[model samples]
Target: MSETAREAILTRIRTGLAQPAPLPPRPDFTAPVHPPLAGDDEVLAFAQSFQGAGGEFYYCETRAQLAVQLATFRERQQLGRPFVWEPAMQEILRAAGVAFQADETEFLAHADWGLTSCEALVARTGSVLVSAASASGRRLSIYPDQHVVLARPSQVVAEIGDALRVMQQRYGTALPSMVSLTTGPSRTADIEKTLVLGAHGPRRISLFLLEDE
Candidate 1:
């Protein structure tokens, strides 16, 4: 080979060697078997985790019991009209003789409580899976002083994977704009490492689980 040709080939080889090699593909675990969804076990696990994360859990079997619970809660907290985002909640409030408004965002801003239905309550992590596309908007869950969730026993799932499957079955290929997995109230220890509640969202989160079918 001519000297110029040999040097050109060496320069090309050197340039290729200087480039970094690509990283390997991430590994995927083999399909692991998970236990069947046990209703009682799931509820127990969720309650434990929820209370541990500073959340209040109320289990009621009847509507009358729920009404009484709300009445006591209202009297103790001295809460006025609450902002309700879901139709089911509106119906419940009307039946319970409680006042609620869904007219505007300003109402929700000053509202003491915000009521909404969750897509799923995850047992493994005690998370409430919420979708922006649902009746409960993004603000309803985050803006109110107290974020109240009205969930049914049928909505409770075994794990996050099951919760995701529920969403998939609900929305199909069309997904929501935003999905949140809230485990507890809005808390942060960012500043000075001192914990603070209601820093970025509601100070308190309460879940009212209904044993309704």
Candidate 2:
């Protein structure tokens, strides 16, 4: 308020601004934050972690076996023909003698199940990394009541970092607009602390592991 007081405050501020503050140390991005998974048991580890998160895991020794397992699962579950959009997945279904719906309008109206392929499977956290870059896009993995993921053993990674690196390398500089990691079926405990499944996404998620390697 006083002229002398203002002058003294300005001088103090000038003195404080004379020296630059020291910057914090940079982190090592090369080293992983968590311990990397060891050995050749990534599939086993993924299966364990995935099942622990309420996901169903089926290991198919071959594509033929995968077809049989898929057909059996469909019949056992009494589910209608699943909605599949990806051309690769459509071919696999057609070759396997499995009927699927590919119509977008029909899918939006009524679809009991949907089939998709993930970008990568994290062995440590049992999370499936999906992106809009794939043909499945966003809806197929979320809209259906039951979501089935077709994955190969080679796609399983040691950790989340490894999965992210795989995506980055695959896409290079042109990355996808949206990338998501789904751990399990959608669930929420927000309503009166009652856990309800399928609140935000598919109620059931099944992973069919095809042993191509």
Clashes of each: 0, 0
| Alpha-carbon runs more than 4 Å astray in model 2 | 1-32, 36-39
Least accurate 10 contiguous residues by lDDT in model 2: 31-40
State the RMSD for candidate 1. Answer: 8.0
How high is the lDDT of residue 144 in model 2?
A: 92
For model 1 the TM-score comes to 0.79
lDDT of 2 by residue, 43-107 (tens): 99999999999999999887688889998999999998888889988987787777888778677
Query: What lDDT score belongs to each candidate, Candidate 1 first?
Result: 0.83, 0.89
**Candidate 1's residue-wise lDDT over 34-143, tens digit each?**
56545567788888778888889998787777787877777888887678877877887677676678666577347788888888988877888987886778988888
TM-score result, candidate 2: 0.82
Give the candidate number with the greatest lDDT: 2
The global Cα lDDT (0 to 1) of model 2 is 0.89
